[model samples]
Target chain A: MMRGESETYGSGMNEDKAQRLEAFEAEALGYADQLFRVALRLCRERGRAEDLVQETYLQAWRSFHRFELGTNLRAWLYRILFNVFNSGRRQEKLNLVPVEETISETIAWDPQTPQNIEDEDVLAALERVPRDYQIPVVLADVEDLSYREIADVLDVPIGTVMSRLHRGRKLLRSELTRYAQSAGYQT
Target chain B: MQVIDCRNYRELLDSYLSEELSVETNHAMLRHTEMCQGCRGEMAARRRLRAVLKRACSTDRLGAEAEQRLRDCLRRETAGGVAAIGWGRRLRRLFEVRGLFHLAAAVAVAAVITAGIGAWLYGAFDGPIARPDLALSPALFEQAAGDHEHCGLKFAVLSGPFEMPDSAVNYDPSYAGLEKVVAPAAAGLELRTVHLCGHKGRQFAHLVYAGEGSLISLLVTERDGKALDMDQIPTDDGIAAGMQTARRENLSIGAFQTTRHVVAVVSDLEAEKNRLMAERLATPLTEHLRRFEQQTAMLSRISFIGRR
Candidate 1:
């Protein structure tokens, strides 16, 4: 009787485990596209972006048992994404940024200039900013993650995240300005 | 409303543009913006840039194809292929697949061939016999090498013609009637053990010989699995022949096709010497194998009669 009861309990536990796995894919996989977009900006390369997103989801699935029931799931996803991204952080992140692209020489913001740069152009310009300043800018401005969230991803303080975001945006503006001038646009 | 100073307003610019600041801070920032022209202009430009970026990045995503790919990848991960298998067991399963088995077999064959070649190459060489379709079977060399390893190099020096062992009593079914064609070719070497090794339904004569400090072998078979990286050398005692030789690992192999069988001589002999020996044996081999095969049907008939 004891053995039969134990078997019944074991089967119940297995069914519960199966249900959790099913629930995870249904509920959590919605964030995968968002994670991938973030990964694309972070890596600045297509293949690496896919790899990063896959790794993030794979890790999230593996660590699903530790997750609290009802927290900020997106924020949690970002945390995990950043952790995975930074863990295997590339030494040379984006090779698109030219060597001469310091902020002082590139951007001279005038209110009179054309502010009609395309978003793809903006992204291209964004990729040209140095990696140190670029990531926080992407997180705060593009992905809409908070400065605190960026800090968790980057393993830096919130103050540092804000500073980097500001600097990164400034660099991006300058780069877009240079890109515009080169393309013979009035901006 | 309390107006914040420039330093504080500068820090709040990012928050304000992102619209994360509260109404109190927003009101203060507006008041401050009215006062500071430089900060206000910088903030305006940054706000425009941020809006453009936000709009763009919100829509920025993997394409439909990549999305499908990721969906498939996730599906595969969640699919019940082996949910209960632990990490260790899963990895073991990966290795147990047929592709990995083929890879292991190929690698083993390569290692054996490499060891055979290295053994010959490191010691000595002159050149190889330039021959067309002179393919050496690494598998055959490996078989002989295994048998040679089993019995060390203290083997009898072969001289004159040797007797063919009885097939039904001594050899495998696939190898029956094979000894008559093989013994004469092996008779000149410092013969060790005469073996009939069968692999994958193909039969071979694995004739081991004591070669220098290492044991060598002559594996003769009717089937030749075309070898790609065979070394070219002259194989002739005046029969139109081409010799392909190679050193794989510790053994040097010399191969040539006769009228009846594909003959491969693999040994610890120097590359040049191994090929020269194979070349010298070609005439005797061609003659003996042809003569033996001519009588093969008669012998089979006699053996059948004896069995009856």
Candidate 2:
């Protein structure tokens, strides 16, 4: 009788575990493609980007128990993605050297947005932006992440995120303007 | 609220566009943009730029093969019971089970604890557990050999005068002049073709050489985790310490890892000859890759500092 009872209890526990895993798969796996798109820009290689996404999902799954339901799961997953990406290069986190904030501050002129800009030109221009600023811009503009969400994802102050996004957009505009002038397109 | 000026409008424009401004500020922004055509136009232009960026980036999606691999990896993680559900909860669940299941659970938990202790004792957690003898998947060997057979030999048969395209630099700037780096090492080999090609869903900078009626393929691919059995442990010079050799059918492959890439030499030569040729090629290639890695790191660091 005790043996039968134990077997039933064990099966119940197994079923619960399976259900939890199934729930995780249903909720979390849907974001893989979106995460992969961002990962591609971050790693700059398809294979590494895929691996990064895989690692991100694995990390997310491991901590799935801590994740709150009905909250912004998308942002949480993105936060984990950035965490995985950043953790891999922990040694590169060197002492902060203060530098003049010249790039964003000096944009005295608002260049008119160019017309007929190829997608390739825009992507190449975005790639040229410094990564520190590029990430925020991509998060806000491309991924549609809010300033607060980007701040959480990047582990920086919200003010820093806003400033970086501002600077990154200005830089992107100038790059687009340069491309337009070179291509002889009327802006 | 204070009356908003042109400077304040410009400063608030991005926030307003992002819908991050408070209601009062948003109303002020609206009033200002309504009166000022310039701010409105700038707002429209910025919105257009954001839409363009989103459209461009959306074109890239996860490849089918990669998605399948991710699913497989997650399945394995689940099957292995590595979901990291806390031990306390697990123990509680174990106790919730009655007689025979309790014994079984205790035994399983004891075994896991023992294995963990043994692994810790062996210093397996010190870094990536390096299984030097079999450091890469057999599929990778087959993929390298397949690229050698299909890309190297078949292209050699076609015998088109192939020059590395300028667009290869878009994939990796190092690919533009890669032949120059490998040329000295390949003394007697006739350089047949060099191009960036994809095989079995992985991209490689493929350089084909012909010597003594045998075709050799030097492939450099990004080191995704599954490409090797262990996480790469780079030495002080930024290249993994030693060569890893594998054989697939008639082909012999010898590979090593730089910080970001895997460099392999695939040929139908005897194991010893292939190993020797791989060693010869590995030196210059590893050195070149190390320098490139350093330069990239330095450039990113400089950019980081500049941005901050």
Query: Model 1 in CAPRI terms: which quality?
Result: incorrect
Every candidate's fraction of true contacts kept comes to 0.24, 0.38
Query: Which sections of candidate 1 miss by over 4 Å?
Result: A1-18, A89-114, A180-187, B4-11, B20-24, B34-44, B79-308
TM-score of 1: 0.46
Candidate 2, residues B102-143: lDDT per residue as tens digits?
Answer: 466455445444544554465422223233322445556777
Instruction: Tell how far residue A181 is off in model 2, in angstroms.
Output: 0.7
Q: How high is the lDDT of residue A161 in model 1?
A: 68
DockQ score for model 1, please?
A: 0.12
Model 2: CAPRI class: incorrect
Q: What is the per-candidate TM-score for chain B?
A: 0.38, 0.54
> Cα deviation of B213 in candidate 2 (Å)?
35
Off by over 4 Å in 2: A1-14, A90-99, A102-104, A107-109, B82-308
Query: Between which residue pairs do clashes occur in model 2?
Result: B135-B229
